[model samples]
Target: MARTKVALVGIGKIALDQHVPAIAASPDWELAATVSRKGTVAGVSAYTDFASFLAERPDVPVVSLCLPPVPRFDYAEAALKAGRHAMLEKPPGATLAEVHTLQALARDRGLTLYATWHSRMAHAVAPAKAWLADRAIRKVHITWREDVRKWHPGQDWVFEPGGMGVFDPGINALSILTEILPDPVHLTRARLEFPANRQTPIAAQLTFSGNVTADFDWRQEGPQTWDIDVDTDAGRLALRMGGNVLEIDGQPMAGENTIMGEYPALYARMAQLVRAGESEVDLSPMVHVADALTLGERVTTVAFDF
Candidate 1:
């Protein structure tokens, strides 16, 4: 069997640590090449610009973009037109409109365009969704607080205009919620905490239509917490470690309790989409972020220095 050639664009931290390794491990994918301005994976043929990458590896039929949201549009658009399927990282584009445009373009070109949401694909997430599918959800509380400095390190684009700061992490919770919940959720109110020296918020409190509220903070200390608690008619469900661990009514569920395996599942889903000759692009998470931004009131807080 010939593995599908996959070119990883923007070989940055995420690419090096997760995406590249996932592709290498998958039997269905072959790491063909890389496109990046300053980053590269070891032993992989690298090109600085897209023009050169396309010129050299025209046989590469799939491109996984691990780049930031701001410039994702141009690269994805170009890849689709060049007859390559694209698998995009979370928060697919800087704005919802651009992602929609890419979706339409990919569909028209008869290409597979996947907006990969890594969080929703976590081990315990699908089970949680199944557990809650028939139950009536009363409320959900998501506490997604983390130490950005430790996790993100020197990535400065996180504080820029399209960076979306705390919401960058917050969107993960939204993705999981949108997947598990039976009905759609809309943001009712939001209070964003912005550092005096930054353009985006470092912390946020958001309320959705169904009594679902999330607290997102990037300045957390000690152990990081990425948890979601769902109150439903069946029982109380809890997801810890960003949906890698699950608890039902305070009893931890057996099996499917693991981590570092989400990326492989994401790649598998992308491959399935390619083989099926279809595209799966969900805009719920991004739409929630955009709604929060539009209705959110910014509050300037203590300035943070990275």
Candidate 2:
């Protein structure tokens, strides 16, 4: 079978670590080209400028954007405008308004626009949702803590405006929460702790409708944590290791213990969407982050430096 050609934009850490491997292993996609200032995949065509890539690579019908949230809209806009199916990484865009604009443009142009949530594709996430769908959700508590230094290292863009700080990882938990719950939830109260030197918060505490709450922090020194525990009328459910591990009522269930499968699943879904001529833009998780930013109380924390 001939695979569809895809141009991977923003060949940074994530592109190298996840996207490239996923594309390499997939039967449906070929990494035809890449657009990045300083990164490239060996043996693949590379261009530093997006406009040149778009103009030269007319045969590539799909463009997957792994760029950071701030500059992502322009690339996605250009891709859709150039008659390419667009796929976005998590959070999709820095603002909800820009993503909505992209959606409209894609619809008008009859192109596929996928605002992907990789965490929702975690191996256990679907099973968790299935288990919860028939049960009654009493409460949900999400604790997403990680050492930014380990994950992001020297990436200062994470502390800049639109970087989303702790919410960057926190939104993953929200994505899974929004996916698994039987009913929708909205943020009610939030407390955000901002570093004295940063434009985004370093930690956040969020309370939502329907007894859902979250605590997100980026200052852990040792083993990182990404776990969500839910209390239901039937039993207790837990998803640890960023939704890769599942447990029910203190008994561990069967699932993958790593997040290695998420991007592959995402790419597969994107292929299906392209084939079906459909767009999947679920902004529920991003909406929760926006609400936390708007309604959250601000607190200044000690200055942090990498």
Candidate 3:
């Protein structure tokens, strides 16, 4: 089988930390080129602009946009219009509307477009999802708190308008929840805490349909925590380590307890979809964020320093 040439755009931390390694390790895909203004990966073709990248890799069939959501839509659209399969990072686009637009373009061109949630590909997620697929659920709770300074460092775009602030990490939780839950969730009420000096929220308390609730904060100072719990008729299901560990009824369930393969799994799935000429366009996760931002009440909070 010929390796699918994948052009990675936006050579940011994530593209270097996760996507580049994943692409290099995958046998079904190869790094054909990269798009970034001021960064480059050794042994990979680097283009300072998207135009040059596209021009050089005219035969490359896949382009992964690992950029921020604010500017992702344009790159993804450009790739789709160029008749290339477009792979989007989590939180698909700046708005829910943009994802739909890219999907339509991909459909019209008979190309595959993947909106991947790296968290959903965590090892424990699929098993937990399968376990809850037939069970009756009572309620769901999520507690995702982390120190943004440690995770994001001096990334100021996180606090800018449309940058998604805490929801950037919070959306990973939403993606895992949406993928595991059997029922649909809708935002009923929310309280977003915004820094006085920033345009985006720093914390959020969201209430969703069917008693689904979440508490997201970017102020934790200790060990970062990512956990979700489900009260079901059969037993209790708890996912810790951001869906990398599972416990049932207060007992640790035995299974693969690793999340390092998330990006690798995402790339493999995207390759499969592209080969099949299908699309993996999931919008339910992003919808929750958009809904919360659109309908939630706002509260001012202290300014955070990185």
Q: TM-score of predicted model 1? A: 0.98
- Candidate 2 lDDT score at position 211: 94
List the candidate numbers ranked by TM-score, top first.
Answer: 2, 1, 3
Q: What clash pairs does model 2 have?
A: none
Candidates in order: C-alpha RMSD to true structure: 1.0, 0.7, 1.1
Residue range 1-306, candidate 3, lDDT tens digits: 779899999998999899998998999999989899887899988898997777767889899998888998889988888888999998889998888899899999999999999999887898899999999989999999999988888999999978999999999999999999998879999999999999999999999998899999999998888999999999999999899888999888844666678999999999889879999888888889889999999999887778
Candidate 3 residues lying further than 4 Å off, grouped into runs, are none
Candidate that scores best on lDDT:
2
Note the Cα lDDT for every prediction shown: 0.91, 0.95, 0.91
Alpha-carbon shift of residue 213 in model 1 (angstroms): 0.6
- Candidate 2 per-residue C-alpha lDDT over 96-174 given as tens digits, one digit per residue, 9 for 90 to 100: 9999999999999999999999999998998899999999889999999999999898999999999999999999999
Could you tell me the TM-score of candidate 2? 0.99
What TM-score fits each model?
0.98, 0.99, 0.97
